[model samples]
Target: MSEQTTYEFHVAAQGDVLEQYITARGRNTFIMGPIGSGKTYGSAMRVFDQMCEQAPNSFGVRKSRFVAVRNTYPDLKGTTIKDWCDLYHNEDCQLGKFNQDFPPTHYLDFDLEDGTRVKAELVFLALDRPDAVRKLRGLQVTGFWLNEVKELSKAIVDMCDGRHGRYPSAAEGGPSWHGMIGDTNAPDDDHWYYELAEESHPEGWLFLRQPGGVIEVTVGKGEHAVTKWIANPNAENLANLPDGYYINQVQGKADDWIKINLANQYGTVATGQPIYKGQWNDVLHINNNKLLPIKSHGDLLIGFDFGRTPAAIIGHLTPLGKLRVLREYVSENMGVRSFMDFLVPELKREFPAYSKADMQAFCDPSGWGKSGNDENSPIEIINMEYGITAYATTSNKPENRWEAVRFFLTKKIDNQCAFEMSADCKTLRKGFNGGYQLRRIQVAGDARYTSVADKNKYSHPHDALQYLAQGAQGEVDYERTEQLRQTSEQTAAADSLTGY
Candidate 1:
């Protein structure tokens, strides 16, 4: 044999499952686990191995193609592509220049130790929009790898499935393998991936869930209490990691973070600091019991927040003084007229028992100003055109509105939360959990937060809720109060003139 260098493959104790994952053929295979569990490395190595296994032509060049997908182009550059390049960039492999044409592709040409040449093309795709699905329509590929499947939707997954097993053509020999491999951290329990892995379990699908490394145990009492993380039986890939890796990682992490990322459990874990913190509990605040249906009872309270993305929360004060958010409406890239059109019909269909007269609308105080081409204010439009009397909140100060919401959440009504939201109101639920959160700043080795909550997709729904709280809590009518004060001063002045 010509002077040759050999590389030996050593399997970690936790890598047995990955070996099994590579051998098992399925229409869809998901390798889900916690951080540093070798999920991405193992998956990428397996795909490379499979591509090398393809039969070579007369020239001894094995040809194959693959599509690696991510949620956005920026993520493709920073994450998936970077990881892939790190894995395959070696002396044996030659990475070709990137093809910047429609549906960009990167070429990898390498030789196995056996002198077999491997020619593989990887197409990096990002499904950032609904139209992005159309880009996958006419592609030919042996297989696909979806990195961080939680960021992707079901429609993108379904579309990718249809594009596999078409490469190398029948003339050069049919594709040796055809399927999809996905890897992700534990996502929300309601995510589509969780539904498929835990609930659906469709035929020809392989779902592998790794056990979490950290287990939290409560110790002591109240403020003096301590929480400890004990190594659990589910800790995999420890042999591949540095000593005390998981231990160091779990320090200063929230309970949800420990559970979702370290424990590898399916639950709603906020990526950032939760706005409501101790006030909102998924089990307590969001459940079948809390998301109860409501019929038209007393006067319906509709809180409206207007903007590029307008939102409305329809609620009613229960007999026990609790505010029950029965339904909600949100729209994007819509005008006031279009939103009203959608909202009016939806209200009619859902709350047929209640009419315009029975509804009292409370809007953002800023809606009092004229916006865009509208000659009248948003409140005026609702009252004049929609025939529903709408009033602006007493104050637009975020602090006051947020305090009202906090009061409502903490208060108990018959041993339950005074404020209850329907599960169907997903946007509002996300906001209360953490999507609407204060901005964190690091100062002198300590973390500090701004008083104002960050304005984002969650802000609109939360603003609607805030307006509702301000309305329900009976804020002082600032406009009317100011008017009365002015009138009183004018009358006193007139009386003084008469006395003079």
Candidate 2:
């Protein structure tokens, strides 16, 4: 077939985000939206468009290969694969039948009206399979579509990204364009997607998010108080769905579910019970303006949570006793010494105005425990090496730590939140928003959660915040107490020397 050959093929991508997503030429492109918002359909159409646009090979044939991925075999069959078939298995566009293999594959080769041949391959794989990585390693493809990417990990995405552009080798005229496309409902704030899209935002990666299907509105007053989910006027793909799809789906569903699946808000699925259930109002406790130290208010307090994943929270206690958390340092698999190396420079740069004397540091009392490798405790390392005197928090009790933070969370001065954190403190904010939580006891019929918080990425940063709160709130002034003890001892010695 000739390069001039043309066959009619068209797929209309609805909504602004989906349209942008389809047209995006970034190396990695992702679209996230509420359920039934046509994310899958748009991704499928984009794949088809990409396949058709491939540069014709030596024999006037467009060649391409694409892999579609989901989290599990069932999800691949039930959702990702089914969506592909629904879009492609039609008279207007003819692609070969999808084969039932260990990893499903569809081989397409058809001639166009003007004698151009289109050849493409579609492979579908599930991550849950034991040989998933082995299969991924063996693939060379034009591109990939990460179906329901929220269920997959960064590693899976990276692996898939590496596989693309390898299928249409240099001999086969290479791919006209190569990249990855992904679609998903909203994921939690702590998710890698959120970190990459919202924080890192590296070059050659694009993320487009459709407006939520519904918006929460307050409907009733105090005694008759109620929150309702109403259809959003700008919601996409409504024309293709049943009447009131967004509204109907929210019926009898929890607010969190509706927020995530319909509203397209980033939130956790709540496998665990939230530590600060009702106390943390994201709106109230989180300041939109980047919080900075109020120099005249009080000294900057640094809180530390030490161990494999060390974390630090830098904040200030205002004259009104409001805790204004300004910055956070969270690291994984780093020793206290290494963490200090990074933190000291950051502290100097971030809070240049504050001198060492103007900053007080507190840490988990357990930081005093020596590990096998290091005879020096974390506290000792910070003090002796970093030259920053750090005090161990009075009580390492979980309840005390929790209550110290709760005291600020529940406290209000003239209706203003006593505990306010900068919007940039995403990790800690996510933790307060439910990332750091207590695991739900999995007893049938009875709902219960453990009293102690579950340890995870969020826990370390939160633990640091607890120490800051505990120290700042006057639970015990370890520094002052020590000074007083020394003063008392000195006074007694003076009296003995005077023979009194």
Candidate 3:
């Protein structure tokens, strides 16, 4: 009789959730946890298990295909691809070079027990841009694994589902197991993943969340101190980490960073002093009372900021003497013509009640220079081509325009803000919440602060808004203007009758 040989290896569960995660059955499975929680390792192990589960055909080959995806090419190469290679270090697998052919493919040809052959082609993809969805088209995959899914949009997740469970060909008896698996750290509450996991809880979807680690630090006399890292009860993979790993990581970090990276909480963190500190509050500024519909009669006041990254804001003067910003449009790497193309359609769609004749535009005074393409100023393009007469702000000084916006942000009437932006205006909301902030300059051999807000992503939208605020600050209220006009007309009629 021939001697038999058995090869045995152990796969230890890193945490309470890892074992359950490896065997969980679902159309879509998500493993979410804090840093160093082994979410990626658990997800990759599941993918390997599914590849091995492919039943052999008549030719004795277990054929399968999977795609390991990330938000960008650099992340794919640097993170997911490395984690995948590490997962199968002991297996008799050969990893092929990343082929640059159309629909790029990476291969991992290996063998299983009982002389069963496995050919698992692993394709790596990056879905970074809006147009990146095109790459997922026409792909037939047994399943897919998305790493750091917080960086990806929900559209990419939906597209992956549509492409999965169709690989290895039906003629080859189809896949034994096929579905999508993903791993992520805590993302913002507004992200779609939060909705899927926290709100929707769709059928055939399994979400496993690991608890965050806690660190407490105490200082003693003479600069001595004691610190403790308490692993959350639900945290996993503690055996793999060094002593005090979680505690050391959070030392001297900001509260927001600690909350996100260590506590695994979802909240906003400001890198510096928020420009609209004490002026804007999410609960107060974004209430329904502040976001009411616009009245139909007043001119649609528009503020324009001109540059390679052009932006515009459309607002109207409320009867209560406040500025209600209704719509905002922003784009980068576009000229005035393209910007107008985007803005004009949006304006017509959002404010169908208002016509071009009822629109009044205000632009940055600096745009009056003949430095643009075709030697025509932005003001010239707006008036001549678009047929909407535009005027530049009276002052181009940054502080003057900033003060104009600050007046609206700070000076309230009857305990209400004088200015409010629609909640749908995300870019502008970011601006009010520290996106438009002063650049912190570190002085040599001293600790002093500078109050100069640097121009950045938030600058253009805020600049656009400043034009509206500064221009409208000196504007006559439509209701007041109409009342004065009527009073003058009535007096003129009485005078005419007396003269006759």
Candidate 4:
């Protein structure tokens, strides 16, 4: 409908304000909508149409340059690039692979037919490398299309805008440079992209928000701006998308529904909103991980995420309600007994304040708890050897646990938390380096998120995050946690009650 129709629609008029506002825009503007809702098609049509019109003076050889960016190469190749190549490249207009054929791994370039060619440089970046987006230097970028702006951060937007300054604007008579587009639907309020950009540009920015089939364009968040909001045509303007794209994007996915699908924001569709979208940014630093000593705010607590390979760990707690994290102990092929022994001494050395009395320890209840098949748990053995009282905490409800971690993540604990880099935990860290990304589901469902799952065959990290969150909520009973059975036995008078 709207998608295919836009291709044939002819507006011979030059620089329609709407088209020009879209074409000449040099600032970061998000074009977010449901999966198919003409997002890919709308962007492609506007860019190609106006660009061809501008290339009248070009030589017989078509040459144009644009950057089609995504979180990774496959996303670019399989989605954005493919869409562009299939939709725009016609016979008279050739799509050629010059000497440089950037494998669709992340992003690539293409030479079009008109004297003007289109160069598509795909960049797969994570938020942790805020500077990574800055690397688009030197390349003469005629236009940039960030396919999934929802997964990107404000830092990246800033970098793209900042770097283009080198290109002289029309005022200087040298080819004046302008940005082609910025687009994403709605993301969580806590999302950095929303916080740093949306909050700041409420009225001054061009915002297109869709509550359902209807799309509204707001000049800014100001009262005057809100009055000027316009609804985009849903029939021919947005009809060509597969019927179920919107349904799959905002409702059925296992994650955020209202903001992403209905409101057209970009973010994880987590119903529980488990890890902060920023966790993506944090995990990106996994490659050059350097342990930053945590500043002690509260009694630091550690949670074990046991794996058959390198066992993962997270140590954090509010000693006196002040947040603090010791080091993260991650290792591979280490036995339970050795881990307990090794970690105890290591914890003692790092957090000297956690003396024999003030310590609280928690591990997954599913495996090796005292009542389980395994006789000695890592916690129990650690206590027997170090004389440090360790608490065996049962996990909190799954949804509740994810919420607890979110509370901490949303709070201001400037000096409280710290992440240390370890050779083994690099994979986990990489998972956190990027912001959570939401994709359009083919089934017409709500949003689904892609992030680091368990490195092990059994994706237990999801479970471990639940375990770690239990302690964060301060629900642990230091003494009575694992002692539930022992206390019950001591109090039970089975011999007398049984009429023996």
Candidate 5:
């Protein structure tokens, strides 16, 4: 190429949201949207914009380095890098050759209209590779772009956070901007992204959500109601997609998939039949406002389901017999003792008004089983090691436990349902909505689910909830059934005695 050959790069943000995302200057910024909402494009351009914004050094050259990261190598290469190349590599200008080594790298050297040269290095890395974390620990980039941030963990993001702002030493006019930017399609409610965007809202962090490509509307009425997805009139990046992109994408997809991927909603894709299918109503059972423990309402009933994944549900049984589930605790691969350690402090912190005396704890009868490492069972440990006394429920029968929960779910006390859950119980809400489910048995003729609910992240918490329900007046259903049995035997004996 001749020295006289000059290049100019031009790109525009697709929509208002994308424009806002590109211009956001938060120390940590992220954008979430549907499939073709220009999230990746906007984030990619933001890096270049930041590089050019940096002040020129003694040689009239603006310099910066940015890393583009994805959770897997295939995604980093196939999607993330492909999108970057499609934008920057064209006929009129060439950014630079992207080296395809272990960790791909690209160097961009261009001259701006102000006569200042922009020299930026873009590195692409994947977290799945064994050496990736080690390599990330050593990077000294000005900023980072987390492509599909939901696929990565908070640990990786935290690590990336510490590695930035160390590049372009102060002596050479340090970087004008140093931080991180990311983009992703809608993630599930259980994802860390949801916690950060919907709950935490940490300082110096900005999260923007673009309009969905589609909107869900319920058709029909009452028992006949069905959900239908229609194209959203205000979807972003429509000019760059096919005529019926959003509508066509939902052709044979599940409602959950359409809601999450196209509608840009936070929800899980249901695989099996929901455990509480028709019985559980999210709109009716889940309170619009967060529920807090009522001082007058009987003692807080805390239920536990112990195992590798220990779970607990805290709620109250009102004098009116209304069951209000306030909070839930779900952990992965944690022991009972450790889980209690994490939980007790949280309970105290969140519910300072309620003391140990105001709380009643119950556990699954299976908690009587001893752990391999310890002589005491989970229930024994809770009662003996900890000052809190946790009693084992009368029966761990699935049918009895299920009936106990169902009793409240279907029961109505003074017009409103006896069961209600706090808005903060996201996991439990998802479970009732369909995360806790019965595995569908593959058969050609008709659809059929297993006799029992499938074990999953949701099931553990649901188990705890069932225990809570049973302990808090739900056991009356079991006792009622037992009384019916005794009545039946007495009637038979009386009939025989009268058969003279």
Candidate 6:
């Protein structure tokens, strides 16, 4: 805001790539290009642009916050925002401010020799608290850029966007849009993004992929004019970082080494490795005609994974543990109102058939489900507000719940249960067959395990499974239910206290 800050990002063959991106960045609602195509660099520069505009806006100092989230902490650190800072502080950009307090949490906002102030600050966060996303609900954020979003659950994305906006101090907050960028290579055959790239209308989200990176561009205006670009930050903007850098970052990780680090595709090429030492034909249902019959009457536990991308599923269970996937619905790119238009009716139709006083749908009842990549909350807000009893499997510990899914599937594999693969449950099957990936394990005592998703990749189906499994046990502690109620009420009260 002090003076015009002149800068450009240098790329070898691309040649002054930042110049074009910096110019057209925010002017267009959304933009996408190949890897090394300058998407992140472009977006970061846009951060600078917003900061420039904010510095002079009389907010004391522009409290510009940039949110960069990934599936886990390491990915958030090693991949997404980490690389963005590299490009932003490159000698060419004339580094203003960086995360000076904690280098890992680099806050880059400094003035160049030209006296231009950098107002943008970053809030580096990871999806550690699945329920924490709702904290953003009813609030507004300046600029939110989700790096590798294919792996982010739809629920959280919506939470961020739902609360997305720039609340410049002293400015009446209406609808402030942020520059949302998504970067990813590609997802598996069953992933949600594969579907998003092809959608058109109030019906779906759009994604475009060029050689190195795939950009997920979300478009709209005011409260929702946010587009995301999903692409590879390494091969694209960081291509000139010398080969050693990638080897160090992604070396041993198979998914990283290939899907992103080396090969650009987010899918797994048949390495011919048998993750499950059994044949798929063995699990084929003999009753696989039109309308897969629900093998009824044995403690029907339903798992409802709420998501938009690949599709959320309603899995019906038999005591044998063999699940009959009853229903599957994908959100495409539509928002909550649209998603619920399909989900509520589906639940109504599906619930009655499986309804027992004890019947329940297990879900990630943490955040508001609004994005294609979000995990669906178990209890629907509309239903709840209307006094509808939406049976949900909410939990204090989600990791335990997710672990249960793996445990149940392993049991199925051991022939300890009857969970068989249905045609409609392709995402689940893919996940069980290794669609999802587990990150490198740190020394046990030192660090915790980190799991990552590849878009609608493996998690969607597994999420469905988790939701179903939640219903298996009727272990509802009325106390816990009360706690959840109290928590929600308390959150609401807190929002009120802050005048949110």
lDDT at 186, model 4: 56
TM-score, cand. 3: 0.50
lDDT of each: 0.75, 0.82, 0.72, 0.45, 0.82, 0.48
Clashes of 3: 0
lDDT, candidate 5, 347-381, per-residue tens: 99988998876777788877877878788788767
Q: Considering TM-score, which of the candidate structures 1 and 2 is the better prediction for this target? A: 2
What does the lDDT come to for candidate 4? 0.45
lDDT of 2 by residue, 51-82 (tens): 77788887888899998989888988998888
Please provide the root mean square deviation of candidate 5 (C-alpha atoms, Å): 10.3
TM-score versus the correct structure, for each prediction? 0.50, 0.61, 0.50, 0.39, 0.60, 0.38
List all candidate RMSDs to the true structure.
12.8, 8.0, 12.3, 16.0, 10.3, 20.6
lDDT of 3 by residue, 1-500 (tens): 12223233366679877778878867788877778878888888888777777888778878889988888887887878777767654344333345646445666555555777667777888987657768877778899898998898887888787788898889999988888889888776557886676546678888776667653323342224333345455557877888666667777876556555765654343355445544554434543222434655478889999999999988888776788887778899999989998888777877787788878788887776877247667877786678675777777777788777767766678888887777666677766755677665666874344566667877898899889988788632234324434665687799999994
lDDT of 6: 0.48
Q: Residues 216-296, candidate 1: write the lDDT tens digits.
A: 544553345455676665567888788777777888986677767876766654445556655555445554333433453
Tell me the lDDT of model 5 at 495.
90
Stretches of candidate 6 above 4 Å error? 1-43, 53-63, 89-117, 134-139, 169-179, 200-206, 212-500
Model 4 stretches astray by more than 4 angstroms? 1-26, 53-64, 90-100, 103-128, 131-135, 165-172, 202-204, 214-238, 242-255, 262-500
Model 2, position 387, has a per-residue lDDT of 64
Once fitted onto the true fold, the runs of candidate 1 whose alpha carbons sit more than 4 angstroms away are 1-14, 91-104, 113-115, 218-227, 269-500
Off by over 4 Å in 3: 1-9, 89-105, 215-229, 268-500
Off by over 4 Å in 5: 1-10, 72-74, 95-103, 153-155, 187-203, 267-270, 274-423, 436-444, 448-500
The candidate scoring highest on TM-score is 2
Superposed by TM-score, candidate 6 places the C-alpha of residue 203 at a distance from the truth, in angstroms, of: 7.9
Shift of residue 92 alpha carbon in model 2, Å: 3.6
Please report how far candidate 6 places residue 219 from its true position, in Å: 41
